[model samples]
Target: MTVRVLIADDSSLQRSGWRMVLESQPDLEIVGEAGDGARVLAIVRREPTDVVLMDVHMPRVNGLVASERILTDAAVRELGAPPRIVLATALELDDHLAEAARAGVFAVIHKDTDPESLFDIVRAAASAVDGRAD
Candidate 1:
């Protein structure tokens, strides 16, 4: 099955980079793109997204806040299960990880990490949503 993905980041270049990596996988589909937390929320609300790769730091709302909202929104939950959100950022702070956990983030990855690892994480997130292993 194909996994519909949404890329959320403030930098166009960052979004483009992630798009390139994700597009290389046949089972991953780029459903939409968002530049900020509010946009991420909007896209998730209307799109059939299976996974969301969102930047931890965004201009408008930020990933942590958006993630918490997405994970808890009744409207989104009614769509079945909310999409798995992966927090992507250059920072590797433990505080970020803790915040992500509180907000229900599936995983946290560095922006400069290996493409293969990123692919693996994305696949795992998708698989987890469907109760499978990657």
Candidate 2:
């Protein structure tokens, strides 16, 4: 099955880069892209996404806040299983790790993570959603 994915980041370049990398994978599908957390929320509410790669800092709402909201919102929950969220940041993740876990984030990775690792992370997150490693 194709894993539907959403890419959320404030930078257009970052979003584009991730899109390019993710699109190259046959099992991964880029459902949408968002420049901010609010857009992420909106898209997930309307689209069926298996994984979300979200940036830590964004205008309007941050990744942690968006993760919390998406995991808890009744409308979102009604859409079936909530998407697994993976928070990515340029800064140290130590401070945000606890809070991100509390918000039901699937994982956290640094912005400099290798492309292969990023692909693995996203696939793992998608697997967690449906109990299928593929």
Candidate 3:
């Protein structure tokens, strides 16, 4: 099954870069895109996507806050398996990193992660979504 993905980043280049990497995998599908954290919720609401690659720094909400909101939302929380989120951060801020764990993130992927690792991370996250992982 294809894992539906949403990309949220302030930079167009970063978004496009991730799209290219993720879409290259036949098992991953690019379902939606957003350039600001302010727009992420709406996109996810409309798309019913299974995964989100969110940037930690953005114009409005930022990835940490967005991830918290998604995890707490009754709609997502009530699901047997909710959309897995892997925040993309330029800097691995310890605060945001710890917060990500508390926010129930499936993973935190670096913005500069190598293509092979990115693919591996996404696949592992999908396994988490399916209750086959920790």
Predicted structure with the largest TM-score when compared to the true one: 2
Q: Please rank every candidate by TM-score, starting with the best.
A: 2, 1, 3
Any idea how many clashes model 3 has?
0
Instruction: Write one digit per residue (lDDT tens) for candidate 3, span 91-120.
Output: 865647788898888887778899999888
lDDT of 3 at 52: 86
- RMSD to the true structure for each prediction, in A, is 1.3, 1.0, 2.3
Once fitted onto the true fold, the runs of candidate 3 whose alpha carbons sit more than 4 angstroms away are: 75-80, 93-95, 130-134
Q: List the residue pairs that clash in candidate 2.
A: none
Model 2 regions more than 4 Å off = none
lDDT of 2 by residue, 56-83 (tens): 9999999999999998888777788899
In angstroms, give how far residue 57 of model 1 lies from its true place. 0.4
Model 1 Cα lDDT, one tens digit per residue, 1-134: 88889999999999999999989989899999999999988888888788999999999899999999998888777776789999988876575998899888999888887889988888889888847555
Candidate 3 is scored at a TM of: 0.88
Which portions of model 1 show Cα errors greater than 4 Å? 130-134
Quote the lDDT for 90 in model 3. Answer: 77
TM-score of each: 0.94, 0.96, 0.88
